[model samples]
Target: MRHLSTVDLKVEQVSGVTIVHFPQEVDAVNAAAIRERVLRLLNNGVTEMLLDLTGTRFLDSAGVHIIVRAHGRSTALRVPLSAAIPEEGTVRRVFELTGLSRLVPTTIGLPRSAGPAASRSCSTARARGRGRKPRR
Candidate 1:
């Protein structure tokens, strides 16, 4: 296993949607890390993004800033930003309280299963955590 300070970030591309799976916590300590990853994807010409917050146990102002910045970048690139939030969780509450849902398209519940014909790419970070080779 890696160090505890390392946040697990997974990105899977399916049907033009890049799913970003966040770790247990997204705060000031790790917000920059997450921002860099997201910006990298955007720079790589990803036109759609889905932020999966099901595993996110907590989020702070920095976390929210990351999301907002991602949203702005997506808008600038004409990419759509969506969110997959848990039905009941602190992350969900934060999004609601901050009106993030209104700013971006969000689906509450499990991530929708990927379909065939969608090119899938799993992030190296998450694959490392699972001790599996990353797929692209």
Candidate 2:
């Protein structure tokens, strides 16, 4: 099998929605960094967004925290923000427990971009830390 990169995330902006894809496991070790990078993107002016968790098989409370936080940010920013939780990932389980599934607009398939590409960047840098803001 081909090896995966050490990078835990990738950023892609299709149409208007910014898609942040997690390509590996997400535990306490890297959850914060993921959260920060996402928030940074939103601060940069991204509006509609989607968290692609298809490759992710694991996540902790911290991961859930970021999603919830992003949901609030999306509301305040008046942008559409949602998650794509795989049908059989551990992520769905956590969401079930927290009832986040109902609160956050989780979805499958890509959403139509609001318009033209707003921004584009595919960085390997997760940027460390958390506890600042949310992304989307």
TM-score of every candidate relative to the true structure: 0.76, 0.71
For model 2, the stretches where C-alpha displacement exceeds 4 angstroms are 1-7, 108-136
> CA lDDT of 133 in candidate 2?
54
Clashing pairs in 1: none
lDDT of 2 at 99: 72
Query: How many pairs of residues collide in model 1?
Result: 0
lDDT (Cα) of model 2: 0.65
lDDT per residue (tens digit) for residues 1-136 in model 2? 2222344577887777798987567766776677777777777789678887756788777788878877887778787777776554476567666777677666433333522323222111211112325766
| Candidate 1: Cα lDDT at 67 | 89
Lowest lDDT sum, 10 consecutive residues, model 1, at: 118-127
| Per-residue lDDT of candidate 1, residues 7-76 (tens digit) | 6687887877888888888887788888888878987898778887777899899889988999999999
